[model samples]
Target: MRKKTNSAIRRWMYAMAYTAVSAVVLAGCGNGGNEPAAGDGKLTVTATTGMIADAAAEVGGEHAEVTGLMGSGVDPHLYKASQGDIKKLDNADIIFYNGLHLEGKMAEMFEKMEDKKPTVAVARDLPESALRTDPSGAHDPHIWFDVENWISATEVIRDTFIEKDPANEGDYRAQADAYIAELKKLDDYAAEQIASIPEASRVLVTAHDAFGYFGDAYGIKVMGLQGISTASEYGSKDVSALRDFLVQNQIKAVFVESSVPKKSIEAVIEGASKMGHEVAIGGELFSDALGKAGTSEGTYIGMVKHNVDTIVSALK
Candidate 1:
């Protein structure tokens, strides 16, 4: 049995965050309009997740001191800020986050900081037509799954850095152009690799629906036990339904996300087995977060390549 639903974890985090935010609001405690640069005069930036942090580093180049709040395999949806994280945010000259409610528990805190700091949501300004929405019409915050969307986000980060530190505008623009060109190549690579999978077997089932953008971009049909947000529940009915899907389509493998528990996917595998469909665990994917700081999958391009290669190997 699953120990706890992602929704349960998120709810608990939200309560704790609400209490913390309330106290902070009451005391009016936060960094008050300090644009203090880093030790070497670079802007100090704090991002909510590894992906956004990577963007800052790529666009800011040596002009920003970047820090990420969430580490490898950390789920952003349910993550709550610690005292240490609050300190980082307070000291940062600017903050970047995925937005679209991706950081469910910390949205309020980010909102509070918008006025005091150059807090930007990289994906929030994207055209709605480019975004996928949930059944309830909320924009899906997993924009990083699509390489092109990620390129757009990188540009957003670049623009924000330029706006914050106009003196480094030339460096930021140059870096942004280089990174964008690299992402274009990455997009082609992903498409080529995904095309290697047989059309009939191009169905990607994972622990959650974080890969919708990937599927849309690469022509794969994505299915997940939970909804767009891991905060959604997956009951026995969901499991049985997904099991039937696997059996019907003769799916050979399902994937597990780094940031989501494998228990839900394991249950799906077990359910498929009972119905006579032998499915394998394809590979671990970086969904809501990236890999370790020094690893290959630590960078956005590398992470996407690893995921594409893993999917192609399992499904081809």
Candidate 2:
């Protein structure tokens, strides 16, 4: 699990981030923001998760240095901060994180630092009307999964990045324009492909709650055992509740997230079996993190496409 940390150090000789990472697998760290004597003049940008980091990279290109707080297959809800992470936050010029309770443990910290930095909530940029709501609160925070929502959110990111670093304003705008075009193509392709699935079979059931946005935008009915945050556990009572639904609704298949454990989902499966409802584990879906670096499901666009393709194929 910790094997990849050294590889990134070979790329960046500045800081060893593994010591601060609670999750064994981490992305990258470097001599970012400022130097000890003379600041590197590079703008220090911090994102709470890999998805946000990837988006910033797409928009900022090489104009900025971003730190992804979460690593491979790590859940953002239960993330804990380390001493080095605190130092990174202290040095940050701007911060981008998924709001709407996605960062359950870090909400207070982000809120406290809001006045100190230009902290933007990418998911919150989507129109409230376009958001999917539940008893929990505002709406789903996984808006990045849907291309249209992401297109809107990217505007927020691009604008915020420009506001912080105006010297390379033109470059950031150009990148945003190009990236937005790609995002539009992504949305169009998702609509065309997901539409092919029969409407009746478009029910998506997952281990935890993250797909509300995907289902709302793509015409699938979503169900999950836990709430939006992974901080909550799937207790015996919770498992019993979802298992009962699976049996009654005759859900075709269930899903397990790549970042979240398979056990919670496996219990759902086991419950179904005991109740005589034989539901298959549809396929491993990329929820929080992007897939392996070079796979078809690696990029944000590809990962979502792969997920939609898998869900449609399994159900329809």
Candidate 3:
């Protein structure tokens, strides 16, 4: 069962209000007056997620200094901007976010920052035809799971840097091209690894619907006990249903996310066990965030590789 629904909602509302008021007050305090000149030093970039921060750093190379607001094991869906985060957003020369309501509570804050600086939603401009929608028609915001989609996001970051700091356009172009090539290779690696999994075992069950894009990209079936956003709640019924699905499909394992609590999946496992189906917990996957900084799973490419390797090892 989910926890703290009412408290979480209240916190989100308070944060949203605070962000809106802070943006207005900060706007009046000459927050955007200190725009960094081209070649002035390093461009200051603030990104909402580690994935975007990784892309900004890779594409910007030595020409930019990037800070990710959400770190390892942080869930953006329920994230509320702190006063410190507000200061960072106010001071950054440019900001990049996943958008598509992934950072739902921070929407107004980003909207307010648009006039102050270059606030780009990397995933917002992806062709709608390439996006997946929930039953209520909301586009899924976890586009980073699809390496091909993330390549487009990398291009968006690269283009933003070029436009903002034309003095280093050549460097940005080169860095972005190299990174995109790596992403293409990563995508191929995921496809090949997933293909190795036995057809009957090519199923991915997780704490939430975060891997829809991964399943779509790799030709695997995915089931989640919760909805796309971690803010969405699940009940005993949902767990029972997922347990039934696993037993009927004879799935060997269900993965846990680094950012989500493990108890939900554990409940499903317990339920399955009661019905005589034995299921194991696959290795943790980096879902809403990356691994600890400086680790193999810290970078975007490394995170995708880690997830793919874990899935294949467990399900194959």
Query: In TM-score terms, which candidate is top?
Result: 3
Top candidate, metric lDDT: 3
Which runs in model 1 stand beyond 4 Å of their true positions? Answer: 1-38
Tens digit per residue, CA lDDT, model 3, 1-316: 1468888988999889885769564574232444453455888899999999999999999888899999999999999888788877766788899999999878877887677678899986699998999999999999999999999999999889988888889999999999999999999999999999988889999999999999999999999999999999999899989999999988889999999999999999999999999999999999999999999899999999999999998887
Q: How much is the lDDT of residue 267 in candidate 3?
A: 98
Winner of 2 and 3 under TM-score: 3
Task: Candidate 3: list runs displaced more than 4 Å.
Answer: 1-21, 24-40
**Candidate 3: 10-residue stretch with minimal lDDT:** 29-38
- Model-by-model lDDT, in order? 0.87, 0.77, 0.90
TM-score of each: 0.90, 0.82, 0.91
- Candidate 3 has an lDDT of 0.90
Please list the residue runs of candidate 2 whose C-alpha ends up more than 4 Å from where it truly belongs after superposition.
Answer: 1-41, 294-296
